[model samples]
Target: MAKSQTKTKTTKPPVAEKAADAATTAIRLKQDLRMIPLDQLDFSPLNVRKVAASAADDAELLASIRENGIKQNLVVHALSGGKFAVDAGGRRLKALKQLASDGVIPHDYPVSCLVEDEQNATVTSATENLQRSAMHPADQFEAFAQMIAEGRKEDDIALKFGVSVDLVRRRLKLARIAPELIEQFRVGELTLECVMAFTLTDDHDRQMTVWNAVKDSYHIHPQSIKRQLTETAHSASSSIGRFVGIEAYEAAGGILLRDLFDDNAAAHMENPELLERLAVEKLQNAAKVFEVDWKWVEVHLSVDYGAFRSFGRVYPQDIEPDADLLAEENALMAREEELAAANDGADWTDAEADEYYSIEPRLREIEALQKARQPYAAADQAIAGCVVTIGHDGALRVEKGLVRPEDIPVAAEQTEYPADGDTEIAVTRPNVSPPTSSAPVPISDPATTLRKADGISASLADDLRASRQHILRAHLAADYDVAFDAMLYALCEQALSRSYGTEALNISISPFLAQNRETLHPDTVAQKMLDALEQDLAVEWMTLEKPDDFLAMSALPLPQKQSLFAWAVGLAIKPQLLSDNHPTPIIEEIGARLDVDVAACWR
Candidate 1:
């Protein structure tokens, strides 16, 4: 019965037959090409490529289409209402739509498309995307280089390709890399970034040298390669380089090597010698302003703490202001207040804004005039010099009022003894021959003359003294009254006797020597405390001219005065352990008075 039924040859149903015929017809019409209107097209829901295009990609695609009409046709399926849905080339469709919206192309602009049925849309879209291959990076770099060699301007090429000028430059830079490096990149031995690093210098030999040295090691990083190539060069951002700007350097025939891949990285200057010379010349020019008012003016490329330590500093002195000057200052202040109030939150015309801002410079000028009036004493100016150098921030730094050691005045020796009526006793020490018989000899205490334990080595004695001094310093720093008294005594001794005698503290008012400066480790607790105190110190007086300094210092509050006094006195204290191991009686007395906790401080 089954054989008979099959032999009967049943006819297919009309609906099924028609469906098969329609599918066959759709397959035949799959490649149907047509000019679809921009406004009549939309993205297909069945598109397999769901990832959105980036803004840069859209811009580039749009630019390409604008420069050259669409080179590839979009795959689309017919929709109801005579509309079409893009199955492939979604980005291209987007760019065309944007152009139509921007009026660059008409809304009905004919877009070439390959029409397909809805059933095959997704498969067709996927095939179109998956089968495409991007141009190799090496080929891209070579193409860009070829275009450039053909006399095409970078800007024009960027415009034509819808890419950034910087990108074009980078591509060219890659192409110009040492041929050997490019080969390594082509063969996968080097990464794109490594190849880019080779473009930092144009000298192929130098690039090859660095490459050969690092290629075999695990440290063939881009930055490491750049470091080796530019080891002998100076960065444009360096203190000296910034001081002598790139423009100035270039004007002086200095060559700069730029990094095409990194815009933020500073360029390297090939002529370091030329840069240094320019820096010195610029500093010398800046020093000329001080040469007239100073006893001597010296130009230094960097701060020489050693040279500065040997010089004494003189501060400015205050002078009484004339009535006219006071009046002028008051007037400027009143005007400034008025302008500030007027401009608080109000939007004003440009003219009004200009007027409001003008008050600042005028006030600054007045302040400068006032500062100028405050001058160093003629006697100080005769001995003090100035040093001009570059600051860490690359600004011109002028250190004024530096008195060289040789220029310091020598105090006259005592030619006359105190009058017989004077009751002051003249002290005689181990070093000085007993004061003339005419002068009363002061009695010396046995306790003060005792030497340190005889068996201690010089080094051990110094260590012990340093330990004791640190303990004493910690305790002294906490007592303002004692530090002040000690400082006052030291100053009076120098003023009245022109010499120190059996002093507990070394109060020379001198900067730290180079060797001594090295011992002050920044991580130490003492140094940390000093740093904190320095942040709060009233240093406005230091910036004032000689005539205004005294007034500014006097204006400081009592607490601020005490802080400055303590800091100054603290710096003057040092280890009193003599090389000969002599007992420092004065230091011992100070420690006893302060109740210094040696164990607590030393640990």
Candidate 2:
């Protein structure tokens, strides 16, 4: 076996310098290196390192020792018998023992040692363990790369090091990362985690792009970097991919890139537009099944609750299943109920638990299939349509009974008037009589009366605003200049007068304007508008945690502040008929001036 040589610098010291150094350190002791038989050595209690006992690693170490002999000498102290206790290189001693046990060497194998006396034996052991140099990560990566380049399989390398194949693959990936990024990692500018994230994509251009984008910011977390790189790409686990299976997508010429080392690794689809087109085509084809029962069938890629808000819904009834399905459903329900009964404080077997969990998904599938087989009512089919969309789980989602605004029924109203030549006559019912007020209701402060003129309930406020919204629109349409001035005046009054003194909480519009908004039932138009405004503003205001934040948000520029104030005022307008059932001339004039069709706004 060959011995490993340590490199040395051969420059000799001057004779005077060497003598002075020897004199300065004359009190320090040095040990002489020599060879001794294994049986003459004992294990030290004060050894700092515990040798690994794993079979694979132990075997590897033994192999290395048998192939190249011990490259380093053990530090030992003299004991009573011609024996010495080894205080350092415990792993090496174990490896040599393993080799001897395998009969590769004699039981009393000759081993090399650096002999130190008892006084400094512990210090020498500690110093050897502490001063041992570790291989640099860059060098390790390069070594792995060299091994791979030499045609060594990843599994073979992992076996050689007693590590996971995944670790070897990871090291290889780290080796292939952009040289600049690797340099950053080596120089301590980027963290190991950040560098590992860059290895997710082998595209050097993309890695550099993301690094340049966020390199200045402190938010260089691994997840953040991954998100930036993959935001434009859809994951194979996404809804679209699930709806359109990976096999089908690939059949349609879609490409998926996978990470070699990520756990629960996600596949990235390169062409999003192609995926979406495929998804929509699938949805459209699915919608054809409902063509017979629907007046019109539409396909949408994504559907939310808000998408159905503008339409009315009608439900399908009497969706009866066939004999086999009926029997199957009943049996499933019975089994589920029995399982549920047993689950109440009952210790169930593993088989029973698995069976219980399996019942729900199968039952849901049956129900959905049965529902698709059902027929819609003739009236509903005549008035409503059907929609096919993709669910979050990438399954077909069918929304039936959607009626457009034009399809909704409106009740007819009739009015009677006197004939032109007939004389005016008053007819009173026999039991009805007009009664005069006993006395005038006493009024307190006129300002208080004015404030209370419009009902103060939340519902009343909503209806009044809806009724007046159209009128406010007409007013603004009549003169933009006047509307702007009105907004400024209102802002000034509220910002100055309202702040300086206690004024009435008169946030609502005039009572006369709100009067025409009254309806048999409370109107939701104003509430919906307010809800939308709040939702839009919530993104800006919801994050505010203090009064100062709110104040800062409120302190908008003059134009923006005026625009918001004007919008609030506009909500008070009503689109009802003017006095004497006359058409609003100002609306007509504005419509003409702006070339706008008034009917669209009314609709």
Candidate 3:
């Protein structure tokens, strides 16, 4: 029954031809501008730009669309079903879509578009966006600045634009640049690199000063500008600033200019005059506090190498402290050690830190008091003074007891040479004549030779004895103490008359130990020991400039002279034996007592 009734309805040839002609006309006119429903339009997946439309731009587009309708039509391609995909004007499509979503327009509201075939979508998208010029960097910076001025936070602006907060801040730095430099940037006369350097300081005058100073020179670079700005102001991290402290400087009405663009936000001290004045004041206060005991105390902000040229140094004298004072000092030292030990295992709190700082000053004051107890010679004190200045390390430095060359006392000339009271007594003696080679001699028998001698032989014996005595006397005069010991030993040996070397009934040392240079090998260790000793001794040795100055050193206290002599003679008895040979008993004993390291000595 169904087969009998299933008749296929077909259009007449003329009607079909008329419908096909109508469709062809519609397809041919598709590229012409017309409005499509917003719901029917979709973004083209082949769009070249990935950035979404900015909020302000979208808002502006929405307002324009509401006020004047779409002035420029979006390029769209026919997609599956009845939908159209945007190719070139995705942003415009988004603006329209946002308007429809906000109910500013109907969801099915018409969106003006220039319809294209699907095959040309990618080429149309690329051509429309890629061929357009991007906004200039200067304009972008200025725009960001304007947004900021309009009370928009950097974070909010970055979020709205889909960019980083840091990037927005960086752009904002450029915006706040000197107006003149901004003008230069706007005209493309200044590079971005040099423009960034102007962000170091906000002072337009200073920026202009640096720019004008370097613009005509070969040093017109970002680094050059940075250096000039840095030179004009002192960094807060500088040694002088750190020494004076930021809080203290600011308390004294100092200004610190901060670098906003720097990642560390570095600060520069603008009030250098105030900083210098504070440093000098602190130094003067310290000098004043320490000047009571000093004959004269001079304060200097900086000491050049030649600053010491006009000054001479005076040696310090030892002054024994009272028992009560010594006990108190020892107690303070113990307390300081306890405090240091307490801080060893833990971090210090603010209070603990302050306590540590407080203790340090008291410890330094105690040290100064102890040092002040050291007495200088009256003569030195009369002409010498101390210098207090800032050290290279930015700490207070006290150079005590300096004497100028002009202050050195001149010695009185000798006037008693061959004077009336200084009598010269002469003693008459039997003249001894020099023997001549032609002098006659007499010989005696072998048995009587011991009893009788030739005159020439006796004279020769006397001459040899006299020459030996002269040599012995010279050695004794050089080291009288050593000579005294040697003479005593000789006298004792003669009294006992040992046959060690006295074959002819005479006692003598012969000074043979001094001649055995190689066997002793004292120079190997002595040289090194003497070098160290000389360095220690130089502190005192440097004081004596002339022979008379050394002689005048006797006016110094007994303890001072002994201390100098002690240091000088410290290496005199040092062990000098090498690894090649055994040492003398006395040398070995001394080495053992002193725990001398032979290998270390050799090294």
Candidate 4:
């Protein structure tokens, strides 16, 4: 046996020494330095360039000069006796002159002077001011980028300026920032923190993404971008629209209404009769948003005729579709009596032995040789018809925000599933749990427990399918809450699927049948809930010690097993409330004021 050696070399560039030397050199430097005489300092007269050799703000420059005082001595060329022209510090000279004019500084003051040899004044001043502090690291490197540009290593320039090569390396970084983003930062309303580094790449398409986000919303933080990355996430408009609907929408500070009947100004028109008719028209238009009956929208409209019109517009959800459609849609569905009449044995796939199969294969082969009994699969055409009916119902529930997210998957499944023949499945929905008194009650008796857990009983299959539906939908969400229906639905689905041929696989869902499994025993309730909570909820740990309603919830026959489904709704809504573009109340309180009565709202 042989072992291979993996060796990698680590490169270390000594940057700390250079930085320390620069700072030390800066402090020890000696020159005739003093605050310039305020009246004499003509900052505006000086031919200084823009900040950082680019468009810049006066804030940092003003702050530094105000805090530290002028540390750099101005080098000037001797023009005559007792007089000199500034060779450098033209910008500093101009600012000092401005400060003096504003009476912000003393009228006369001492100044640091670098009276250089006249012949080489420009050369000397340029060389001195081009040092590290006068220009930023990026700007400094840019000013002398020639050496690094012309085959010389960046380390050489770094050593020359007594700065780290990495500090100089970012010169490349600054240049690479998307020009669009740089302009945005310059505009003052936009921030650089929102823009990702990837968006700054030379790729113009990627650069446009950053540009588009900023353009759409003046302040697009990173989270906003991430949310856009997944279109499944709620939008500012869509979520509120669906949950509140038009009635709630108008109640909130959203949809504005201006209609004929409500307008007193309409009566003030010069032609009273015409105005009255026009007012009716406006009211009709206003009422349309609420889908009010024709009479409600138009006072002249009759209730009976309007009702007939409404019926024509509205379609029944539970209507069965064509028999052929069901057969086309669902393969498993078959008539119980007919299927029983046709069957002698179930179709079997014989197993062949190989290294992959082993002894287990032998068992499967023996089992295949034995008599096969048929297990019931639901009537396919009927189930498909139910699905079509349920789809609209689910949409209505979602539009009203009446159904919690946890209930969506299960509800969706329940809408589409049909009753079984021999299996005798029922859709059991939980009753709402009432608020508890100070003390908690014990659930010692089975009958008493079932009573308290009061739930509406429908077909078992529907309930099981609802749970499966929830699980499927839960998979769509990235967030995991502890009270999601998805997990409960998944658990029910698992039991139902395995029960077809394997009696051993059938599970007793009685524990969760009445009570909201998500609330009563969340771990056994919904996996989606756990995943959502793990993704979104901040664990306080203290809430864990509080009394749980599981015992009482379990006692009810079909106590709303989805009570905690409301809790998952809260989790989902919490993020919406806390988001940056949250409504005025949310913006003012920063999501602190979000405790609303869901039960009362629904009622």
Q: Estimate each model's TM-score.
A: 0.55, 0.54, 0.40, 0.25
> Which is the winner by TM-score between candidate 3 and candidate 4?
3
lDDT of 4 by residue, 1-603 (tens): 788888978854679768888877566444433334444433322334335442233443444465557777776644544555676777666656656667777657566765545676556555656663544333443455556668778676555544556655655454444666555555653443334332223445655664575455422444333323322222112212222234433333332211111122101111223322333354345445533211111122111111121111111123444455445324323332234344322432233212112434444433432312221122221111110001111121101111122222323232232455433455432221122222222222234445744553457547645765575457546555433333433332222121112222223331123233235443432445444643442211111100111222222233244433333233223322335564556434643365544344332
List where candidate 1 sits over 4 angstroms from the true fold.
Answer: 1-31, 187-194, 216-221, 305-307, 319-374, 412-603
lDDT, candidates in the order shown: 0.71, 0.66, 0.64, 0.38
Off by over 4 Å in 4: 1-56, 133-232, 237-603
Q: After superposition, how far is residue 267 of candidate 3 from its true place, in Å?
A: 3.2
Q: Which whole-number lDDT from 0 to 100 does residue 383 have in model 2?
A: 68
Q: Is candidate 2 or candidate 3 better by lDDT?
A: 2
Answer with 1 or 2, whichever has the higher TM-score.
Answer: 1
Better of 1 and 2 by lDDT: 1
Over 549-582, each residue of candidate 2 has an lDDT whose tens digit, in order, gives 2333344555655555654444434455446487
Task: Say which candidate scores most in lDDT.
Answer: 1
Please tell me which model should have the higher lDDT, number 3 or number 4. 3
Candidate 3 structure quality by residue, lDDT tens digits, 1-603: 565767789776998999999998677666477788889999889888888867866765565565556767788888889998888888778777877888888999887788777888889888988788878888899999999999999987776665668889989988888888889877866777679878777788999998887676422445456656766565665545656778898899887765555555346677878987887788878888657766778776555433454454555766776566577667777866776788572776778667665766676676777786787665556666777876544567788776545454443221223434553543222121222222222221233334544434777878756875676678668996555434333332222122135332255432122335446454678556754653443222111212212333433455654444554234234434457366567777766898977686663
